[model samples]
Target: MAVSFHVRSSSYPSRQHPQAAHVDEQLTRLRSSETASSSSIRQRLSNLQDLHDSLEKMIRLSVTNHALSQDQIEKVLDGSIKILDLCNVAKDALSQMKEGLMEIQSILRRKRGDISAEVKKYLASRKFLKKSFQKVLKSLKTSQNKNNNDALAVFGEAETVTIALFETLFSFMSGSKACGKWSLVSKMMSQSKVTCETDANEFTRVDMEFQSEKSLQMEDVQNLESCIQDLEDGIGSLSKSLIKYRVSILNI
Candidate 1:
């Protein structure tokens, strides 16, 4: 019975042992795990590459913004320089205007002084002429009273006095060379005032002392007429002279 239970050795595989089978299965599982780990590493590396590209783009943007800011700063600095140049030009123009105003003020002051001096001189000359004429007439009257041939001598003296008074009055009045020249007695009559008779009547009414026969005659009437004509001419000349002088000053 023991001999019938014995196994045949030729039916079993030579390399196939129970321990060896378990080792093969373990090695296959380990290979599959290593392949899965390699796939996970490749995924991590791809994510890192994306992050690096984003960082590079951000850096480029920062550089561009910085360049634009620098350009804006340069433009502001250039504008400031131009503004400063304009300010300097305006300052120069203001200074020149100030100087011009000062010069104009100086000229006005000088002209005012000159006008004041001319006016003073003109007034003094008029005052002297009035005083001198009064004194001359008083002295002639005193001389006539002392003479023995009083009436005849007074007539000659009066005529001489009238002529001298005419020359003095004309010179004081007329501004031009017209004062130096005179016409003869006959020529003067033609140019005389047409109201001579009215003037004589007026003179006679005013001067009561000259109404006496001893003092007034045909010659005295002629002399009086001549004196009246001379006085009228003098007044006209003085008016024209004053007006002309004023006009000349305004022109200057």
Candidate 2:
């Protein structure tokens, strides 16, 4: 995504325009989901899907062209595509996690030898996925100083919050906060119990249990399998809305 461009003064930052106000209202609702849980993220994505539907209406109206410049449209389009890619990565992570979780469950069913090896494998994949998210996030952040995620394009109010939401979504998915070299996911796995109330997302629960359990419990694996399935469904919904929104942008 492109960095922050020169702020076009005519672009209304007050969000007085009805579409802008509507977007703000929807974003406010999404923001209310303060927890970093899978359910919270899913709610935000679903809400954003509705918000994009409104954006689609805006795109079809003649006023949308007046609201955003040709350059701003291109910027939002570029950033939107990147957000789509980010969503795809999240979906892939969920799929892989689901696959790994099923493998462990199979072993549990068979009453096989050391489940630790399988647990280790799952954790390794988590670490790898975390790093993948970080690499993409770093690329997104480079644009933030000038235009992206945190400080998205100034003439791009319609998409500013939209981009920010995707940033938040991915950040939570990756458990991106760091303790030295380790991500929050890695840090949580090292500890025995889930002491932190806010860090009690589905993935974290799974990680903590895998580390603390003497023998990997079938119940926890089952719970994580459900979590993966839920996330996959959420990503599918979000991706659908995003593609429609992208098409709307093109039509304008």
- Give the clashing residue pairs of candidate 2, or none: 3-146, 3-147, 4-146, 4-147
Measured against the true structure, the TM-scores of the candidates, in listed sequence, are 0.19, 0.73
82 Cα displacement, candidate 1 (Å): 64
Query: Which residue pairs clash within candidate 1?
Result: none
Distance from true location, Cα of 231 in model 2, Å: 1.3
lDDT of 1 by residue, 36-141 (tens): 1112222322322232222223223333223334434343233323323322332333233334333433544565544333323433443454454345323332
Q: Tell me the lDDT of candidate 2.
A: 0.62
**How many Å off is the CA of 236 in candidate 2?**
1.0
Which residue segments of model 1 deviate by more than 4 Å? 1-215
Report the error of model 2 at residue 213, Å.
Answer: 5.4
Q: Please write out the lDDT profile of model 2 over residues 64-83, one tens digit for every residue.
A: 55556676678768867877
